[model samples]
Target: MEKQVKKKKKKRCSKVKKKMISSLLVLFAILLAVPVVSAQTSLNNNVPSSNSDATLTSEEQKKLDERTIILKEYFLNVEMAKAELDKLKEAQSENVGPRASLVEIDKKIEVAALRVEELKEKLPVGLEKIQTAKESGNVSALSSAADYAITEIQIFWDSTQSKYLAHTAGNFTSTNWKKDRETDPYMTGWRDFGGYDGYSVYSLHYNINIYNPNFQTIHHADHTQYTDWTSTASTYPDARGYAWKYQDKGYQNWPIWMTDWADYNNWRQLGWYFFDFVGGKPSGNASFSASFGHTWASTTINSISYPAGFGWSTNSNRWDKGQSKAFTF
Candidate 1:
């Protein structure tokens, strides 16, 4: 009975030892697996495991994109500024009046251009590096550089536009003058005559011939007389006969002193017969006239005519013409 009890106790002790060993093994495995799992979770959460080389995050990529946009905007602004500055320079040169302010504007444009160049130099890399980074999709660095470049460009453009506005305003205030002259001669006749308004004198002349029947010979003489006359009457009476001749007989060889020669008998009794008359009718009557005149008139009364009133002044002592009112009260 004593031996059997001892054997049973030994068996129970062996079984207890086996169970303790199994529990220890399971506990050790759980400890080791905990560290490994924690390490893997930390690495997965922090970085992309698929490509261990990649270091940039989504936030970083977004920032790079924003910077790139800014850079592009600034660069475009710089180009715009340069164009505006060039236009201002052209306008300044073409302007006939004073443009002292335009020099200052040009200086500003040059300074802006220099600033842009400086910004470009300050960027991280040379052209090659930027191109490589761009091709590689490293947008963060590229965008940051672009932001700085664009800022410089925008400043330059704004300054250029301001100066351009000032130049345009000056040109707007400026004035211009031009002169023109008439190149054709005046046409005047009994039918229709055209003449300039401001002309001083308009003269016309016609030749005359006389026949002496009493002397039994032809007495031919030519004389020209000019008058400030216009068209003649459409119908007039013949001077040689008692009956009135209704025809277009232009005035010829009529004395200046004699008036009221509308009567045909009165003109004939005075020995004044129209030349080129066939059977008491006018045949070859021809005349020519010339006119002279002024073309332009001045705006100010002081420059109306010439010499005397050209540079005259009013009671207010103001310069009327040829002087700009800009920058002066």
Candidate 2:
């Protein structure tokens, strides 16, 4: 009885598997027939088929050809009009045209702009839409507009011509060597170039520093001493430039100063350094100035004497004069 039951169950499972296979076969057949039916319907209805490599109807082909011709003609006209406008500009710049030529050139520029807009409008849609319409051969209601604006470039150039001078003093001497002394001359001057609210500087040459100065002495108690003299300088395109304005300008500009401090010993005890800025902006009257300071100190000892065995007395211990060089642009 058990063996007979098992055989019956196996037979039922096989029958169910056959039914599933048969259903899949029918579905596959229907899918295969769908494209063939669609092609027949497209032919009967006289409509362009979406199937790959399907040929267009005569009317559709004619319409496509007309659009292609229009596109070619507009492209040609745009190129020609652009060329003519450029020629007029060149002629005007060379002073070849009469006064009336200005009016004529302006009119020509307007016409060129209109021609560009017309050419742009011919496509009516973006590249993706244009391709879709071309494939479907249906372009009955398509339109577009063009927006063009003029960008102006204003040039400016100026330099500091006036001579404004300021000075700072550096001098300290003591008999007893057991102290620290410092001299810092904050010397800075700036002149407005004026006339430019916003600008870019392509070239510049400036001079701002401490000049004609004697070195103060730092005497050690044991007759050993080091003369103290040091300086620094800087130039900024826009020192007082507003922060928000730089965001639109697309760059951040801080003061551009000398990286290393100008040190002065016996041989070198004077001008901080010169500046040559190539490209910078914030056009208009730009103010610029520099400041300097110095310090002198003696090493601490048990006891020291002044004006006796120190053996150092010079008239160049003080800064005599401060001057500025000619600035150029």
- Which candidate number maximizes lDDT? 2
Candidate 2 residue runs with Cα over 4 Å from true position: 1-60, 122-329
Give all TM-scores, in the order shown. Answer: 0.19, 0.20
Estimate, for each residue in 1-329, the C-alpha lDDT of model 1 and write its tens digit: 99999999999999999999999999999988863322111111111111112233666444433433343333333333443444455456675455667677668667766765665454322111101112223111111111011111000111211110000000001111111211122322221011111111000121212111000000011011111111111111112110011111122133322321111100000001112222332233211111111112221122222212222223321221111011100
Candidate 2 residue-wise lDDT, 221-264, digit = tens: 11112222211111122211100000000111123132111221
Per-residue error for 241 in candidate 2, Å, reads 52
Clashing pairs in model 1, backbone N/Cα/C closer than 3 A:
68-143, 71-146, 74-150
TM-score of 1: 0.19
How high is the lDDT of residue 2 in model 2? 92
Off by over 4 Å in 1: 1-61, 124-329
Q: Give lDDT per model, in order.
A: 0.24, 0.26
